[model samples]
Target: MGVDIGGTKILAAVVTPQGEILAREKRATVAEEGPEAVISRLIGAIEAALSLAGTEPARLAAIGIAVAGMALPGEGVVAFSPNLRGWRDVPLRDIVARQLGVSTFLINDASAAALGEHCYGAGRGVNNLVYVTVGTGIGGGVIIDGKLYCGACGVAGEVGHMTIDVDGPRCNCGNFGCLEALASGTAVAREAKRHVAEGAETCLPQLVGGELEMITAETVFQAAQKGDPLALEIIAQAASYLGIGLANLVNLFNPELIIVGGGLAHMGNMLLSPALRVIRERAFEVPAQAVRLVTAQLGGSSGVLGAVAFALQQEAEVRP
Candidate 1:
């Protein structure tokens, strides 16, 4: 069993030993209602998946939860989640474990996605890789020598927080010029809102019916597809920053592959082509030439499937 808890929704799945998803369930997080409400919804989702699979709780080997934000997997605590309202030092793992009388563990969503990609998706058979999900925010997971590197504290794969520009816009994480602040979907929309507010000449306003607040990264992409100059420029700038972030990863890890996922990846070449060009211009030639950037094969299911992998791996580690 695997569950993924995000800011907006919760996903639960029953996965086979071979990484096949047998059944799954999803529900709104409604995080603003507080931790208790969110936890209840999470449990409900898990039970729904189990029911969908027609399996009893005792029949499951384990449950792994992948959550957005900082989770201390070893400690079974969600130390802090910027997106989960009122979630701090919450004992999510233990709570779920106790509630269902089933073994449960926690992992960062991005880290889980990385493990999922490495084990069953884009990074399969690769010894070193990074899985980066670019959406409302940017998150990453680094696999070194085919092992997940969680750093000294188990929260290491925070590629989004890396500083890109020393003097750029502020990020929700309170950092200036962080990669997430400049290249994420939120950043894309933020840029568009600014342009629209300034009365930029583009079809963006028409796309959102003059409601600047309705502009989103998807809206920008839609406009760009129609050759809206402002929209094209916004995407170009975001992709450039993304490329810079990837270049830094290349120089730092020298991974053989980098898997890009999440909502923004839907732009395909429009986003990746420019980013690849920037990477070639900036990163060391040797590493740049060796790294292959590709889209994730597993889409939204990556995190949940990764949770499944984590549960199985942890279980194996503890088996007598």
Candidate 2:
């Protein structure tokens, strides 16, 4: 079984080698209820998925969890997390291992998604790949020589947090001018609200009735699709920043492919077209030609499937 424990939701699923989802379920994290409550919700999700899959206890091999924060092996503690509150020194792996008597592997969500795509999705045949996600925040994962690269301190491929501008907006992670703070879904929503408050005539402003509360990323995307020039500008700027970020990744890693995922990627070619243009225009020739940037193929299942695959790989290594 595999679990994706994010700030707002928990997704549990039984996945197969062929990327098939046998069964799955999800629930909100409800962090306001505290750490124990979040753990209970995670446990409920696992049991529900197991029941839905009709898998006997003996047949279940292992469990993998994709978490949102920084993690270290053997400790099972989330050292730092901007989204999940009161999660310091939390023994996550130990809790799951003791409660279920199953070997549990923990991986960050972005890294897991990269592994999943490399193993079964767009980067299956590629020796090197980077999966970048633009959503509530920006995130990325790196795969080198067909292996996930956690780097020193298990924090590699954190391209989103990389400083893009010295005087840019502040990020939730306390960084200034990160690509995420500039171009994330949340960032776009904020920009929409700012334009509305500034009396910019936009469908986004009218759709939210001049209130910033209901202006979400989805709404902005819809407005852009309907030819709202302001909304289109916002998305283009985001894609431009995303493109620059990718170009930097290309220059640094020289990967064979780059897979974009998350809600923004759902904009499809509309967003990718501008991003590709910016990347080609900015990136060096050799790295640019070697890279093929594409959308994520597995859709939303990448995290859970990647978690399962990570566990399976660990088990495979232990046997011989």
Candidate 3:
């Protein structure tokens, strides 16, 4: 069983060792109701998935949880989560383990995705891989020599917070000019709204029926596809920032592959092509040439599939 606990939703799945999802269930997180409520929802999601698969809790060997936060696996606690309101120091693994009567393990969501990619997705057979998820925020997962590197505190793969500009716009993390602040989905939407507010000529306002708050990164992509100059400019700027951030990763990690995933990846070549061009021009010549940049193969299933991988790995480590 694999559960992905996000801020707004909890997704649980019964997965086979071969990465096939036998059954799945999703539920609203209702995080604002506090940890206990959210945990209840998570448990319900798991049970629903199990019922759908026609399997009992006793038949499950183990459960893995992918949390969108800094999870201390050793402590069985979620240290902090920006997305889940009021979430701090919650004993997630123990709670789930006790309720389901099965061994449960916790993993960082991005790290889980990284492992999923490394084991079965685009980075399969690659020893060194970097997985960057570009969505509302940017998150990264690193596999070094076929091992996930969680750093000393298990919060290592936070590439989004990297400072790209010293005097640029402030990020929600209280930093100035983070890669996330410049290139993420949130950034794209913010930039578009800012430009439109400043009297930029574009059809976005009309598309959203003059609701500025309704502008989203997807909106920008859609407009750009139609040759809307303002939308095209916003995308170009965001892609340039993303390219620079990716170049830095290439120079630093020199991984065999970099898998770009998350919602923005749906933009296809409009996003990857420009980022690749920038990487070739800016990153170290040898490493950049040696590295292959590709889109994620798993898409939305990466998180749940990754949870299963972590569970299997944990079971393997304890067996011997």
Clashing pairs in 2: none
Rank list by TM-score: 1, 3, 2
Off by over 4 Å in 3: none
How does each model score on lDDT? 0.93, 0.86, 0.90
Please provide, for model 3 over 1-320, each residue's C-alpha lDDT reduced to its tens digit, 9 standing for 90 to 100: 98888888899999998889999999999889988889888888999999999999999878989998888877879998988888899989988898879999999888899988888899888999899999999998999999888898777889999999999898978999999999999999999999999999999998899999999999999899999999988888888899999999999999999999988988877888888899999999999899888899998889988888988988889875
Q: Work out the TM-score per prediction.
A: 0.98, 0.96, 0.98
lDDT of 2 by residue, 54-109 (tens): 98445778888888887654466666566677887788888988898888888888
Show pairs that collide, candidate 3: none
Q: What stretches of model 1 exceed 4 Å from their correct place?
A: none
